[model samples]
Target chain A: MIQVEGLTKYYGALAAIRDLTFAIDRGEVIGFLGLNGAGKSTALRVLGCVLLPTSGRVTIDGFDVVRDPHEIRKRIGFLPDTPPLYTEMTVGAYLEFVARLRGVPSGRAKARTIEVEERTATRDVHDEVIGNLSHGFKQRIGIAQALVHNPKLLILDEPTSGLDPVQIVEMRQLIKGLKGEHTILLSSHILSEISQTCDRLLVIQGGEIVGQGSEQELATQMGSGGYLEIEIGGPSQGEGRAPVEKALQAVRAVAGVLSASVIREEAHVAQIKLDAPAALCPQVVRALVAADIDVMRVGRGSAQLESIFLKLTQTGGQPS
Target chain B: MSATFLIARRELGAYLRSMIGWVIIAGVLAVDGLLFNAFALGGGDKRSSEVLSLFFYFSSGTTMIASVLIAFRLLAEERQTGTINLLYSSPIRDGEIVLGKFLSALAFLAIVTLATGFMPMLVMIHGKVSYGHVAGGYFGLLLLGSATLAIGTFGSALTRSQVLAAILSACMVVAMLVAWLLGRITERPLSEVFSNLSLHGLHFQPFQAGIVHLRDVVYYLAVTYVALFAATRVLEARRWR
Candidate 1:
């Protein structure tokens, strides 16, 4: 639904985003992953038709961003990093104004406003002034304005930015609920936020696309192997780190296991960090069981994605 | 509604709902009333027409000042608050945004200018006052207000700070107001040019004296058109920035 090629934008003599090339299919939730000042907002601004790119081409559906911006504007909804809200306006009036501004018919604008308010879970504050709403409610209202016209594409810059943990989770659920209806492109610096909500990621660094794929695909491409955490019950007779270390020593001998170390030890349980590909977790578990070590629980660690992100941005990691 | 009218309506509503609007209106009325009572009424036993003309004279100053204050926030405040992005990303053209904002300011200025009608009605109490004079003077006030508001709109579009917008527009209005003074010192064709371009002296005097010259009408409209066109171009240029 969206195609961008050689999208370079410059602010004065400095380039903000250089040679950004990517395509997103219709109905896909695409995450634009980058660190702060990684040119993610600049690129999104170009696509949102808010800023004219210094060079390159961007097309939404079939209309060119430069030549047919008005047409593309009618087909897309954009939320900037800070929500563009009139603080004096009530939520309902603000949504209706945006709906009409986006070309929704006067007769249907009110109904469309309510529909999006419900979708974004902002119905309770419909009559409240935007300035009085909390940051989370304001963010939801921001999303609601984008959705009020029922556009085919939603471009949200930092949708969950500055929200508390609960608000972030609620925003994630809100975005996940929007998955099938519209092609979504959202940007964020938070790894787990993007990983949990996006079907595909376009990792950008230094104004360029360094990597693009699913989580496992990125780990595979970058050879940024993941680790696993194993919890053992009682540590095999409550000895020192020896019995726990010995149990992990057996798991290290399993194929594809790179290293192992004890992360924490307690009265009844111990957590071991196994440096191995997550795909070999089953074999490692079996190896622990063969050594008569009681494995209580096992799960993949989050450090893998963090390493992949760091390598891609900090060291120019290669993409497949 | 069309995008232009919709934007104008919202902007008008904003002015009406905010305290700044009423404050400005009240200030203009108070100052105009004070000048009317002190200078126009208290001086001597002047003719009714003379009193009416003095009323329009001081009213023009307040109107121009109010125009600068009112139009300074039209576009600059949108940029200050980041609400311009909403208008930028919308399907409306840049010209529509500029025209819509100008129309709203014009509508509000009309209300403020017309609210002083009672002052002229008081002139009719003692002596015979020409209705044509009242109509012509008001017509001039609205025209002057419209032209200055358009210039202020252009100024607002050039900056993000409302203070800077007000300063820039006030400077421009002052420059135009002083053109007649400049005409007095310069020679021949230059003097003639400055006099013709004088915002209040050469252009607005006939209307102040109960004559509605078509050239003056056309001049104010031309200024309004040029200024609004410049404001629209400024908005379009911002997309590239």
Candidate 2:
């Protein structure tokens, strides 16, 4: 649905984004992960057709962004970091205006507004003034505006930014609901926020694409593989580090285990960081069960993701 | 509807529903009426044409003032609130956006300018007057308003802050208003050029006196076209910026 090559944008002497290249396929939810001021917004702005790239080229749905922006615009919906809302307008009215602005027939714009309001779950506030809406509702309405015209591609920049925790989850669910309907390219500073929602990840740093793949592909590319944290308890898992290591011997002996370490230990419980593919969690748990060790709890190591993100952004995905 | 009208309708709705729009309208009406009563009516024993001319004269000032206030927000507020993104990413031409915004502001300014029509009818109550004079004066006000609003739109396009937009618009309009003064001081062809460029002295006077000269009509229109064209170019240049 999108192709970008050597996309560079400069504000006078300073380059906002430089030599950024990536592609997104139809029906794929792509996450643009980067730290703040890492040029993610600039890259997305180029794709959104809001800003002309200083150099290079971007095409959406087979139309070049520079030469055929109006054609490309008809095929895309964009939500900037801050929702572009006329606060004085009601949700329904705002959506209708956007629908018509995006080239929906005037007769159909109202019905299409209703359709997007329902899809984004903003139907209840259809008549409510947007200025009176909560942050969560405003964000939902923002999504509704983007979806009002039913564009093939949705470019959402920080769609979940500034929302509360619950609102964040709801916004994520809203974006996830849109997965198959439109090819979504969303950006966020947090790794785990979009890690699950995105079918593929493009890690950008310093205005360049430093990494691109699925989450596991990136983890694997980072050379640490996937991390699974296992909590083991029971009398056999003794107090000392030595006993805990001994108790996890069978888990280490699993076919795909690369390394294992007891990260934390208490009287009868231990947290083990296992270096292996997360898909091997079942076999690792089975090995523990066969060894008669209590498998107290298991969770994917999110800390490793933070470290991976840090490494990717800080070292430009060099892993050192 | 076409994108131009679509944008214009929404913008006009905003003006009707928002405080700034009404505030400017009310303010212009109050100022225009005060100037009408105090100067045009207060001056001793003037002819009906003079009274009507005085009405258009003061109305022109208020119209230009209202245009600056009305047009300053056209593009600047969109950028300030980030709503320009919606327009920028839409499948619409920059000229359409500029034209739509200008039309909305013009429509609203017309409403404000025309609301003062009762003042002219007051002239008809106790005085002898030709309806053509009233009509011509109003035509001149609309043309002046259109040209000033177009200039203000260009000013708004140059900046994101409405205050900066107003300042810039006021500066440009003042420069054009004083072009006749500059004409008085310069010599020969340069002076003639300045006089011709005078937004008020050379062009608007003919309409103020009940004569719709083609030269004046064409001049106001040319200014409107040039200013609106400049505003459109500014919008087009923003993406590259």
Candidate 3:
């Protein structure tokens, strides 16, 4: 568990994060979503005890970060925006060194290293020099070092940053695999990145947390309402596209259906974006299936977080 | 203390595994050997003690230079590579981190200094050499290296780039090296003050001549203390920045 209240950090006259308050429960996987300079890294650094907050209180499990940082450091593992690594060291030696530094007993250091290497799937490259490894491997080694100590919480800043698509998928899967063990709070700019791995999200903007919830909960609470995106395959065999349109129009005529627009048109699939009140999602999905339209995908709209995030940060005068 | 030694042991291994360690050792020994042959034994029949004294004289310069070179990368490289975050986020105290780095550099400098012992033995064999004199001279070399390395450690802590670290350390060493000349130009009390402040003038001369005064030992220890203390404070203040 973690508790942070009014945690404000100032870099000279500029306040990086101000009046931030949040508490994380044990075993919760939370995503920290923010635009650039949104104070995510600053907040994470304060929580990790790597940077001191100028004014506020932060405690991990019961130990105050400012007064008892060393004790807090024993309970949390931190990976900064850029994976801090020693290029000269091999992956195995580096992880083992971190394990010992985090107070793992020498007798159990190797076992702990092996445990984390396997957990992060870095065992195959254990003997390779960190400098020689690819970016993905180096990033994995960075996470491995943090996990090797087996701390209570993991604070990863931009975990999938700068990786190619494949590497990003691998890193996301690796983090997902770690969900149940550690209280993970990861930060990223990509929505899909957070949506796939995190159970809930805390969207930050301009040093303040604007929205916090699961995808649907946030869309519902923001009051801009949620939209259902249904991608249907080509027109039905004998029935024309009018049935699909009439069915959609009929669904819109249903109580919470506000409006709909076509977003994308691939060869066989047509993507539709809905702007609707929060209550009409189920009726819309049911109407499509009842009309015998082959739905390739039934999911939420893509710009749900973007709209909510921009409203919070780009507001004229929003405070924490 | 356990954390201090744990960090120190790893740092020492880093030095041994890297090419820079062997470069300093090879460079210093090769220069020492060449100087020993060119100056100490090149001329005619000199007293064994004088030849041994010359060997110590040339070795002192190289040892001081080597100390600066070896200590330049201690903290600066970590900052450059962003690896200092590991130490910053770890449970170890700031003072422990500094002592760990200082101890590692001192250990490697000791190895390099000892590698040239064969030249001293050669001086002893052909001439009438006192074992105590050689011991005293080597002691002086080590103490000088330790003081220079400590100063270099403080310099390295001030900057993030290795080039800037070396420049700062060289300037600090040169200022102290020139203090003796300043002492020569000034009046009595001020001259005496500069003389004592000169890193090698008053303190190192006694050890160079086969005598180990407690005052000289105390001065080196004091410099080491002040420099390492300053470096630790610098590391701690960085988190705030």
Candidate 4:
């Protein structure tokens, strides 16, 4: 449903996105993973028909975003990070307006508004003034506005940003519900957030796409064992990092540990990055325990997505 | 209805719902009344035409100022709040957006301008003003307002913030208003150009005095068209940024 080739956008002297090329089939929810300033938003805006590319070509459902914006616009729905809402309007009224604006016949706007309201589960606050609603509702309303028209492609930028855990789950469920109806391109800086929600991942860095595939595909192709970072706490040791090394080396011997690097050693704790199979994760923990080098906590290695992202996207331009 | 009309209806609904629209109308009415009583009727016995002229005179100034306030929010607020995305992503043309916005503001301004009719009718009761004079003066007011609102729409399209839009529009309208002053200070060809460019002095006066000149009509319409065209270009150029 979407095709892009050599798409680039430059904000005078500086390029926001460069030579981006990707295509998404109908009914697939694709996650755009990148750190902040990754040009994810820039790419989505062009696909949404809101921004014109500096060069290159993009077509959605056979219509070029540049040459036939009118047709392309009709086929896509976009939810920018900040919900574009008229605060003074009631949620119901706003949705109705957007529904009609997107080409819903005036006669059907009422039914369409109600349909979206129920779809996003915002019926309770339908008549409430938008500004008075909480941030979560506003976000849902933003999604509703995009879907009210029932566009073929849904371009959502950081849909879960700035929401509480409960709200996040609600949004996640709502997005999942939209899976079969629209082709979705959702963006997020956090790796795990969209990982479960999307069918495939398109990892970007410095305005360039470094990797694209399913989680398993990326993990296998990225056979650098994925970076596992750990912090060790102890009184003292050789080079002040030997005990941590001994414990990590034990995990390495278990078969899945590819490599481990001590990124930092401060006080009793040390930070380490490990590349290993998921099956070997327990052995790494057991090795640290056996060596008697008190291991604080071990989560998924940072070297997986975060480290790979850093290398893939040279973090020079990423926001602090 | 046309796409333009659909957009206009939504915009008009917005005007009715927002307090700023009513404030502009109420404020203009108050100013128009005060000016009528204080200046037009306050002077000693005078010709009815003179009094009517005075009413049109003060009304023109307030009307122009009101037009700017009404038009300043047309596109700027949409861009500022990020709601312009809805319009941009729709299957609509920039021209429809501009024309829709213009029609909405014009309709609202006309209603506000016409609301002061009771005051004029009062003037007509105790005095003798020609109906042609009243109709001509109102026609002039609407045309002048159309031109100013169009210029304001262009100013609004250039910025995202409503405050900046107001300032830019004020600067543009004031420059046009004072063109006659520039005309007074310059020489031959230059002075003539300035006089012709004056949004008020040269063109509006003929309409205000019940003298309908095709040239004045053409001038206002031309200004309206050029301003709208510029506004459309600004919308298109924003995608590049």
Best candidate (score: lDDT): 1
Q: Give lDDT: candidate 3, residue B99.
A: 92
Q: Residues B1-241, candidate 3: write the lDDT tens digits.
A: 8788887888888888899998999999999999999999988888888888888888989998999999999999988887787888889898998899899899999899999999989977877888998999888888888889999999999999999999999999989988989999999999998888888878887776678898998888888898889989888888786
Could you give candidate 1's per-residue lDDT for residues B1-241 as a string of tens digits?
A: 3899988988998898888899989999999999999998987799999999999999999999999999999999999988888888899899999999999999999999999999989998877888999999999999999999999999999999999999999999999999999999999899999998989999989988889999999999999999999999999888776
Candidates arranged by TM-score, highest first:
2, 1, 3, 4
Model 1: DockQ score:
0.65
Query: For candidate 1, what is the recovered fraction of reference interface contacts?
Result: 0.63
* Local distance difference test scores for all models: 0.91, 0.89, 0.85, 0.86
TM-score of 3: 0.89
Scored by TM-score, the top model is 2
- For residues A181-233, write the lDDT of model 1, one tens digit per residue: 99999999999999999999999998999899998878777865678999997
Model 1 clashing residue pairs (backbone): none
What is the docking quality class of candidate 1? medium
Please compute the TM-score of chain B alone for each predicted structure, in the order given. Answer: 0.98, 0.98, 0.97, 0.98
Give the distance in Å from residue B206's predicted Cα in candidate 4 to where it truly belongs: 1.9
lDDT of 3 by residue, A108-221 (tens): 999999999998888898898888998888888889888888999999999898899999999998998888989999999888889889989988878988778887667666
The list of candidate 1 runs beyond 4 A from truth reads A228-276, A280-299, A318-320
lDDT of candidate 2 over A194-258, digit per residue (tens): 88799998998888888988877888888777789988883443344554766578887998888
Per-residue lDDT tens digits of candidate 2, residues B75-145?
99999999999899899999999999999999999899889999999999989999999999999999999
Which regions in candidate 4 have their CA more than 4 angstroms from the true location?
Answer: A225-311, A314-320
